[model samples]
Target: MFKRSTLSLGGTALCGALLASGCANHLQQRSEHEERVERKLLDHTLQVDIGEPKSLELPQRRIRIHEQKTFEVTEFEVTRNYDRYTPYQPWRELYEVPLGAVAIVAGVGANILNVFMLGHLPDSVTKDWIDNGVAGINPFMNIQSHGRAQQNLASIDEVQRDRRTESTSLPWSERPVEVQAGTQSYTLTTDRSGVLRLSLLDSPFAEQDLSHVMRLRISVEDDQDNVRSDISLPISGSLRGKLLEAHALIYDDLEDDDVSQWVHRVKRLSELGLEEEASELEQSLIELTHNDPELQKQFLKSLTRDAGRLVADPQASN
Candidate 1:
């Protein structure tokens, strides 16, 4: 009975040990699998969030003016009819004159007498009658007002117009990289698994506030150290989940000075036979000047001139 009990106890211990070992192995395998999946995602994915373009409202104001006035005149005529009264002169009655002629003579005599009386009238009375006509004296001299309708337009924050909305893809993890937009530039690198990363030096957005959306063009170097074609794209959150991502290195508003510097840089790059770099700069120039036809034309002219010089003097450039 004692041997059987010992045997049963040993069997139970063996079974428990096997179960514990199996559980540990399973956990290790699961951990390894999870790590592999994570590495794979990092190698294959690149994510980005481009920012929206900034803008501002323009200035506006309202003003109004009003005026109202009225005037009137009246005239009175006084007449004495000689026909209504018998002539005071009895001798004049001796001649039977036409009644109409007598009335006309009386009117003429009355008008002449009134004019003589007016000439003798005081200067103030005569001036009052001449100046005022039938209406009361003029109520206003020259109307003068110093006050003006006033308004103030608020100062508006300048908007960024040269920025554009663009989207594209890049094999960022495959090589060393360069990206340029406006005056900003970014350098990139990748891990062994091809996960892309930005370099701190000459990075446009390193210290700037990152936008969820950004405009950029990506360039990469292959194994041969040759730059590949540029990839233009917007780095934005709308894209479905991805393991890797890149962004523009700019946050502040782009200015004319920045564009001028970019132009100078493009010319310098072209002069040295760096065609890929110059091409990247040209693409950025086109984007910046896209909305202004004249500016675009001027930039293209500069590019053409520099390109011609480069082609004509390759050895000199070298």
Candidate 2:
């Protein structure tokens, strides 16, 4: 009986030892698995320090000045280039004068002369005199008169006529046209052949962030007449969605219309929680082009060169 009891005690001790060893092995495996999962999670997550978006700054304007001179003694030509000058000087004048003071004086003199000579001036002339200067000086009158001028200018025909009548009409062909929205600005130009070109005047955003799908509406007008209809094109999509989805609606071809489309896409992406994915896709599309020669050439031709340049720049990365 004593020997049997001893054997039973030995069996119990061996079973307990095996169970403890098994438990330890299981716990160690679980710990190793957890460590591996943590490492993988850390590896997949992007580690980036995204600073505040930089504000867009406009580039300095380039101006070319030319001089013409005629001499009777000799038919010699002398050419000199001068930098562009601003009407306002850096230094403050001793007697500070507000803008349009001269115009105001001239306008008042003309009104007085007309009233004295004609005994009564025409309503249009009277209104012009008031709107031009006399009214502008008074805050209340300025608002009323400026409203009328804006109304008159809103019409295409009236704007064209005003430009022709006013000696201050800008030379649209020679002038550099640009538009600003939020932090971005775009410069527009037309070649001799009349092909429109657009460039980014200021771009402080990451190129990848700019790759969301966009719609552009372009319209051309000449002499107060519609020369061309509006064109809507979808652009700057991810590599997977290169083509812009078609829309049946037709809007005006103003640049503002294109801006509206950009806003719409951004809103949609934000709602979907796919903003990061969209940015990544754009980056991938940019990288892929460099690997494929045919794609690089085709992309440059189809897409505007400016788009290609923005995507290609290494500095454009966040």
Local distance difference test, candidate 1: 0.38
lDDT winner among the candidates? 1
C-alpha lDDT of all candidate models, in order = 0.38, 0.33
TM-scores, all models, native as reference: 0.21, 0.17
C-alpha root-mean-square deviation, candidate 2: 45.8
lDDT of 1 by residue, 143-184 (tens): 111231122332322322232233334434334556664356
Candidate 1 similarity to native, TM-score: 0.21
Off by over 4 Å in 1: 1-193, 197-254, 258-262, 271-276, 307-318
Write the residue-wise lDDT of candidate 2 on 1-318 in tens digits. 999999999999987665333211000011111111111111111111111222211111221211112222212222322222112222212122232354467656777878777847664554454444533343222212222221111111111111111112122243233333234544455444333333221232222223342433333333332222333333323421321121101112323433334334333433343444334433444455566666545543433332222334432343
Q: After superposition, how far is residue 179 of candidate 2 from its true place, in Å?
A: 9.1
51 in model 1: Cα distance from truth in Å?
A: 33
